[model samples]
Target: MDYDVIIAGGGPVGLMLAHELGLHGVSVAVLERLTEVDETIKAGAINVPTAEALDRRGLTPALKAAEERNRAEYLKFVRERFGESAGPPPPPVKFAGHFAGIWLLGDRVDENDPDLTARGSASLVSGVRQQDIEVLLEERVTALGGKILRGVEVTGIESHADGVTVRAGEHAYRCGWLVGCDGGRSLVRREAGFDFPGTPPEITGHQAIVEMEGHEQLSPGWNRTGTGVYVHGPIPGRILTVEYDGPPVDRDTPITAEELQASLRNVSGADVKVTGVRSATRFTDNARQATTYRLGRVLLAGDAAHVHSPFGGQGLNLGIGDAVNLGWKLAAVAQGRAGEALLDTYTAERHPIGAWVLDWTRAQVLLMRPEPRALAMRGIVSDLIDTVTGTTYFVKRISGVWQRYDLPGDHSLVGTIVPGLEFADGSRPADHLHDGRGVLFDLGAAPETGGRVRRVTAACPDRPDLGGLLVRPDGVVAWATDASGGESPERALDTWFPPDRR
Candidate 1:
């Protein structure tokens, strides 16, 4: 085999999976159609879990820099549009996320809430662009000795019992496994025959950066017009408009300035004339998911596995989450460190998460419609989201701070992002999790941890009752304990990382 795993698409998700596999010393290849990364910001929000995932790998510095730049840009945009205020420019819009254009306020989140406190929710949401995320992941992948063959368009895929063959251009390469990360209309998914079933779109949405003479006519902030919703500002000339028109026949057709202007007028009911267009794209609420994330030796991740509306800014985050969940599992199987059955858990754990995201977007699409019932429902949701409890719930959901898998464990902490436990040395559990290995965080000096699972001593300041935790490479709690009185932690370790397999 030319590589242990071959990843199609060199976008953020593909690069992230490559980085994870590379960290485990797995031979991997990434094939991307684009010669270089696109600088335009596609999805602009990085949720909490994604930030933590990057932080564990020492990539938080880059993410922070991008966050700062994004914040500064937003501030500048606001000041330019509204003029500098005397009272310190209104604290950067505390409520950064929304559902169906209805804003969810961060200020409404009760810091003292018991559940929120236990989750160890940090200042995790950011407005960094997808391009920045790709750059950071690409850098890490290359540094870790992974090959990313850009400008190589994947043409065909053939899977055999022993391995899979990927055909790109004039070359055909063999790998033990193949992964599709190549976006919604994925070639690998189609050719490999993965059944993607979901709802078709009822509306078309357009986001563009354009230069217009009459841009001032369209007000900033969310506007629920008689036709559809149009949100402007947070940046100059940045327009996001939704039309109730049916899904377009050709999503791949390049968006022209005139077409965008017409759609803008139709949705906004304003004759905003476009002078020049910078960049634009079209999207829909057409949600879909592969029946199974894997088919024999071929697998799927990111957009290749599922597709949903960008309503909650979940597309990029969901894709990265897939990479995080699949990377270590796939690497373990490829390296013979674990059985093929381990790969089955990836689908079992992630399919529900993907389904939830698809449904989440579907709900938002329903709320955005002009129907009287939807409008009434939108009003009710708007009120609920303005309160402390409701805002916290949405924030937790959108930020992915509440993500939990259904692992076999009795502890409430199991299958959640391990609480950010701090140590006496001022280092946290995340500090030791960088190597992409499962951790037996022995808070009570547990004796069973040694070879396969790395052991660490940390103070569980928040939950002193918990003696230890078995953390997966993705920073998820596989098993956790309230005390070392039992052998459950050790048993959990054996179940997940059997020494016999190694």
Candidate 2:
């Protein structure tokens, strides 16, 4: 095989996957049709779980810098909108995400607070543009000696029983596996004949950065108009407007400044004139997911596997999750260290998450419908969200503090994020995960274990009950043991990374 894995599309998902594969010494190539990584400000909020994923790989410093830039921009906007007259900026906003058009309080959702957790300190959500994430991933991929071939479009794919062949024009690269990380309308997905089925779009959406003269009059929050919903935000001149009267957009047509202005007016019922357009794009509420993430030797990730409205900024987060989850499992298989059965777990674990996100976006679309019933529903949701219980639930769900995988084992912490444990050495267990190796963290009694696992001894004052934990490369707790070793740490290691014949 020319490479162990050939990834189509060098977006954030593909680049991050390349880095993950590279961490495991897998020979991988990324084919990107674009001459350069897109710099468009796509999704910006990297939820907590994803931040933890990046943190595990020693990407926290850069991630934190990116997030700080976003926070600065947010503070600037708040200052321009409300000066000292507002009295200390009203303590910044808390629990400030929204359901439908109803805004939640902001303090509860602040990602910068490391000590902000239901039980203890949790990882902060990183607020960086998706394009910036791709750039960072690309740098890491190159640093790890992975090859990313830009301006190369995937033209053909042929899957054999043992390996797969991908053709970009006349050049054919053979690899043990082919993964489509391309966007929605992915050629790889179409060529692989994966089944994509979901609900059609109910409304067309517009996002753009433009010079809108006197645009400050547009209220800086979610607005439900008679026609649809429009969100003016913490970022000035950035607009998100939805129009209910819509046949799905012809994505082939470029979105112009004039077109975006019309959308702004229709949705906001305001004469928002766009003097110039920096960049504009169109999307829809059409939610779809591939029936199966893998088809034989060819697999799918990111937008290729699922497409939904850009509601609540879930698409990018979901795609990144797929990359991390699939990366380690695929690398193990490619290195002939694990059975093909290992790959099946990728779909099993991620499909439910994808399905849930699709439904979540659909729910937001339902609430945003331009009708009295929709308005009433939004009020109901807002009321529910105002309660302490509702506030905690949304904070967890929106911030991804509640994400848990159903890995094997009966322990409560099993399949859940093994809460970030700080040790006596002032280092985190995640610091050892940078190499993409499963971790056997011994909190008290050290385990006698071996094979594709990194063993560490630490004192976790936060989680004293966690005597030992077998953490997957993806950071999911595969197994845990109390001081008595309820679940043998050795058995858990053998189950995931067995010391067996290749």
Candidate 3:
């Protein structure tokens, strides 16, 4: 076999998966037809959940630096709630302010508060450009001994029981599995016979990276007009503009300078001269997702599995998530340390979420439109809606923290997902993944009975309730019980990760 795993696209998602697999010492290779260049594509937008995923993987320092302004892209998250002296409000109200629980709080009201920086998930999310993120990922993957072959395209793919075969540059390589992170037009997905079904992006949007000298009217936190949405002030001077209506854009073709200039003129109402064209891409809000994330030995992730509107800036964020979700599972399966059943969870957990992304982005295509009718309706809703809780709930859901596979019914407290915690490992005490070992977190200091479960003292004061949690390598809690270890934790553990040879 040429490699254990071959990622067809070298975009953010592909690079992230490669990096994740590299962490587990997995033999992986990434094949890309496009020669990576220094261009700012995805205007830095790291949502809360994505930042958390990076943090859990111990990549917080690198990702945090990439978050340029360190703040969310919304006003305030509003919900339908009745105050002590008022009646029930409508859906969440979004304003140009920093308020959690609501989704649409993009602009910075104040930059002094650390929490307002949107630095972390469960707290806030900062923005990061796609180009910078890709650069970081490429470095990490290469550092981890993973092979990245740029300008190499896959002309053909053939699958067999033993392994899958990929033909790239007159060479036939075999691998236990083939993954398609190849973007919307995935050659691997096509070769694997996985169908990509959904709506194509309808609205035109463009993003470019530039070191802002200064902008006069971009203040008052986040600024918006009927032509487009201009988000500003996470960083003192940096700004991001979303143009819904502009010149026709073709993804397969190189974006043109004229198209960008025209879009800026029509949307921003001013011809803003950019210092440097770091990177530019023209794509509409498309709502398409792969029917199945997995087909036999082939699996799909990121843009390969799902493609949607970037209004939520979830395209890159969600793609990174797919990598984290599947990386450990792939590593375990390849090392024979996991059962085949473990592989099925990848699709089971991610496919539904992918579908949800398409649905939500499709909605944004309408919700965020700058049309007079849409604007008037939003304004009315904003006024009628006094409570911001509903909107906050919706935004939080879209933020991806609401995505939980191991639900309450799926397992007990120990079987749920445990937030990253600090623990001591005997002689050498340190903080690592709450997962990785797939051991159920026995926070109760479950006595040293001869068993497969590893009990550790939960040093995190915030999650005292999760002290006796049993965690899986994929970071899902398998079981949660009292300090007295009896049958429930053991049963959940047996079902999750069983010890045979030991």
Candidate 4:
């Protein structure tokens, strides 16, 4: 085999998986179609789960730097808009997120909530671009000794009992495993014959960074109008318009300035003229998910496994979640650390999340419609979103704090990302995950470390009742117990990190 794993896409998802595999000393290579990273206007921010994943990998410094840059840009915009009279730029409204253009204010969130209090640095959303995330992951992948073959579009795949053979143009590479992180129109998903099933597109949305005239005529921030929805100017020259006029005829066609102008006018009724478009993309609320994440040796992740509307900025975060969840499991299987059945859990755990995202986006689509019923529903939702309870509920869902896998054991922490527990030594659980190994946080006489699991004996002042925690490499809590007697870690270890399973 040319590599332990060959990833078909060098987007953030593929690069993240490559980093994970390389961390486990698995030989991996990423095959990307683009020669250079495109500056397309994509996801503008990442959610809590993605931020925590990166934090575990010791990428918080870079994330903070990116956040500062984004903050500076937002501050500049605020000053320009408010004429500098507004003191300190109002600290750039830390919003939880939005639903159907309805903003979820961060100030309204219940900070005492367990999910919110548990997340240390990842408690807030990070204002970083998807392009920035890809670049960061690409750098991390390379630094971890992973290869990235640019301009190598995977054309075909042949999955055998032993391994899979990937074909790209004139070359073929063999690997123990192949993951399709390729976008919505994934060639690997098609060649692997995974059944993709879901609803069709109903609305067409345009997001762009353009030089335009009459831009001021549009409302600032999210606006749900009688026609559709349009967002203007948090970032200079940035605009987004949504119209329930069906999907684009040809999504492959380039988005011209004229087309953008028409969309802006149709949605905002601003008569805006897009004089020059810097970057643009067309999207729709066409939601779909593969029946399974893996088909034999060929697996899928990111948009290859699922595709949904970019509303609420869920697509990028969902892809990152898929990559993180699948990365360690695939690496363990590829390196012969675990049985192949472990791969099945990837689909079992992620499929439900993907389905929920599709439903979430579909709900937003329903609310965003300009019809009377949708408008009435939107008003009720808006009212609910204004309250503290409503804000916290939506924030928890949007931030991914509400996500918990259905694993064995009745413990509350089981199947949830272990809270960012800071020990007596000032080191957190995330600090131990940098090496991509499972951790046994031995708070009160936990079991000894297995070959693949690292044991960290530390005193947590806050949660003294927490006896110990068995954390998977991906940060999910497999088993946890308080000071009193509960389920032992042996079963969880045997299931997730069995010693020398071949």
Candidate 5:
């Protein structure tokens, strides 16, 4: 085998998975069609779960630096737009996120919510572009000694009982497992014969950064118009328009300045004339998901597994979650620490979340429709989103703090991402997970077991009732117990780590 794992597509998800696999000492390689990272404008920010995932990998400093840079750019944009009249930029508003076109103010978010508070520093959204994330992951992957082969497009695959052969033209690369992290139109998924079924697109959307005439005619921020929805600014010259006319006739064709101008006119009802386009892309509300994430030795993640509209900026976050969830499990299997049955859990856990994301984006598409009923519904949703409770609820959903896997064991924290609890030694749990191993936190008297799992004896003053926690490498609380009595970690340990069979 050329590698234990061969990842198709060197996008953010692929690189992240490569990093995880490499951290576990698994031989891995990432095949990317592009020689260099594309500067195409994609997701502009990451949700809380994604932030937490990066933090667990000890990439918090990088994330913070990127966030600060984005904040500075945003402040500059604000000052330029306000032009000295807005009183020193008003200290840069903390944005939580948005639902459809409705903005969820960060100030309105319930910070005291148990779920939000538990996430620690990861609770806030980080304004980092998709390109930046790919760069970061690529660096990490390279540092871990993972190979990234660029300009190698996967054309076909032949899956055997033990391994798979990936064909890129005349060359063949063999690996024990193959993961398709390619985009929505994935060749790996097609070759592997994964059933992709979902609703077709109803609306066409255009996002672009451009130089235009009469741009001031369009209002700033997300505006719901009679035609559709259009956003003017937050970033200078960045415009987004949605129209329920149908998906783009040809997505591959480059977006022309005239085309964007016409779209701006249609959605914003403004006489805006786009003079030049710096960058542009077309998208649709075409929601789809694989019937299952795996097909024998070949698996899927990121846009390969599921796809939906970019509503609420969920695409990157969803893809990041997929990488984080699949990475450790795949590493375990490749290293012979677990059986093939463990891979089944990947589909069981991620498929539902993928389905939810599809539905969530579909709902937003419904709200953004130009029809009368949709307008009424949009008004109602907007009203609901105005209240503090509504803002908090939307923040939870958009931030990904509400996601909890359906794992066994009745402990409340089970199946949830273990809180970023600070131990008595002043080190946090995330600090311990950087080595790519599961951790057993012994808050109270808990039996110590050895395998791949690391047991740490520490007291968490915040929750004295919590005796111990068995956290997976991916950060999910596999099992938990109270100081007095709770389910034993034997079941989870045996299920996930199992004594290494040498």
Candidate 6:
């Protein structure tokens, strides 16, 4: 079998990447080990940036609809036990970064301020389930002309000079480029000889979908204490979970009911009745990062590149970000629109951010550890919550807006995230970002692109911020400025597109 891009792992990030590229008419194949979407909804929510990424690609409506339906049924279930108010009623978040913030994301989210970014709320985020997200993405990808091959576990990958050859159960799939979203312990990364380095989880956790009567209120969307994380995501009838710092069990040991109840006692200070033990297994908050993200034609993403404590729920989200970053560049290179040099930027730009995410998750996990200094820091944080200033740094942890690599200082404005803007004609500047292409904002009357590059213009409050901003597929502003009728944006274009005037 031949393809443009073959994504190993049918998880959310791999599926999302496939859908994104398939929308652009890029041939993508998702090889997943699982046969069904199921109810292992570990990643329960997505943030503003990820939502916008989905929105730009036209998948937000299904997500919003699903959330709306889930909200009505969920609010009623909690109200009876927790009274009219459990903590803080959930907030209405309709803008870009809603789910990314923790406040409205949790059971009783902090709705102190809707306009100003809230640090506490950012940490309290909870919503969405992996199965639900995958179902939505699968339907979308198929509708947009993509292919998904299930029950195909990739056993090996051999990157030749021309492309990559993948072996999946007697199926030899060859592709120009390969993406590894296969989670931690990725077979592709191992085959490619990429090193995964970091500390293994100091604390182990067990996740389950147990049933408990009269304890519905006790099961908040997620409960965090010095011990670990307990997610109580409402899939209406069922509750899914991804936990850490769980039962006192050794590595690869089965979770015991006594351990779970004991941890519950420590965290909630109550003898929580445990029943209907659906699934239980111990997991450590091990933090790891791949030495390099790319090796020739093989690349790693999601849990493949970095696996950290799931405290921030960044495991799946960060992998999707990696997909969003690489899908286009691989497409561009395959189609010969850009040089191979563009591929180098994938690791250069994303690896650092991946490492940073691991570091932050490690810090959060450390606080959950049984260490004295860690407990002190955790107490410091708990007491300091009222001081909004003390919560500012964590806003990035929840919001995910702070995870970015260095940008060329030329357009200090360029390094920042490009706010989606509308032009006089009611056109969204982001609408033209598809089709495996780059966008150049031409402020001047006519662009002087020598034929190889394309330019379009849009205006907004900060449109005057630069001559014109050049944006790459991953939404990084390549170049821009006060249009001093000068040559920087054009120079930047040439830097990537080069002087190919055909």
lDDT tens per residue, model 2, 1-502: 9999999999989998999999999999999999997755589777777888888888888887887887777776666666634432454243346667666776445454432343222265456789778878999999998999999999999999999999999999999999999899899999999999999887888887778876767888788888887877566567888888864548778778888888888877787789988877789988999989998999999999999999888999899999999999999889888888889989998999999999988999999897888878888888888776676677667667677777768888888766777777887777878899998888886567854577788888766766888889988888887865676666567667866447
Predicted candidate 3 versus true structure: per-residue lDDT over 1-502, tens digit per residue: 8788988888888898888788878899999888874454454566655666655655666766655333322211111111134332342222222221113543312233322232333234355667767887798889899999999898888889877999997988888888888887778888788877786555666665443332342332334567776554333333455666543544667655555555555665764554445556666766777777888888999987887766666688788878878987788777676676877878877887777777766665565677787766666545433344534444455545456664343324433245544444421111245234555445664444246655555444544544366665555556555443444555665555556422
TM value for model 4: 0.97
Q: What is the C-alpha RMSD of each candidate to the true structure, in Å?
A: 1.9, 2.6, 8.1, 1.5, 1.6, 4.9
Winner by lDDT between candidate 5 and candidate 3: 5
Give the alpha-carbon lDDT of every model: 0.84, 0.82, 0.62, 0.88, 0.87, 0.65
Report the Cα lDDT for residue 61, model 2: 85
Q: Where does candidate 4 have its weakest 10-residue lDDT segment?
A: 86-95
lDDT of 6: 0.65
What is the per-residue lDDT of model 4 for residues 1-502, given as tens digits with 9 covering 90 to 100? 9999999999888988999898989999999999989899898898888998998998888888898898777766666556677444334333366888888876788878877787876556489988888889888889889999999999999999999999999999999999999999999999999999999998889999999877668777898878899888677788898998889999999899999999889888887788999999999988999999998899999999999999888999999999889888888899898899999999999999999999999999999899999988989999999999999988889888889899999899999998988889999999999988889989985867555587888999988889999999889999999977577788899889988766
CA deviation > 4 Å runs, candidate 4: 84-89, 92-95, 449-452
Candidate 1 per-residue C-alpha lDDT over 278-397 given as tens digits, one digit per residue, 9 for 90 to 100: 878898888999989999999999999999888888998898889999999999899998889988988998999999999999999899898899999999999999998888888778
TM-score each candidate.
0.96, 0.94, 0.78, 0.97, 0.97, 0.83
Model 3 residue 134 lDDT score: 83
Decreasing TM-score order of the candidates: 4, 5, 1, 2, 6, 3
What is the total number of backbone clashes in candidate 6? 17
Q: List the residue pairs that clash in candidate 4.
A: none
Using TM-score as the yardstick, the better of models 1 and 3 is 1
Position 67, candidate 6: lDDT: 69
lDDT of 5 by residue, 1-502 (tens): 9999999999999999999899999999999999999887788888878888988899888888887887776666666566745443344223377788777776777778887878766545488889889889999999999999999999999999999999988899999999999999999999999999999988889999889988768787889888989987667788999988888889999899999999889888888889999989999999999999999999999999998999889999898899989998999899897888889999999999889899999998898887889888989998888887888888888878899999989899999998978878888888889887899988885666654577888989988888999999888999998999666788888888877655
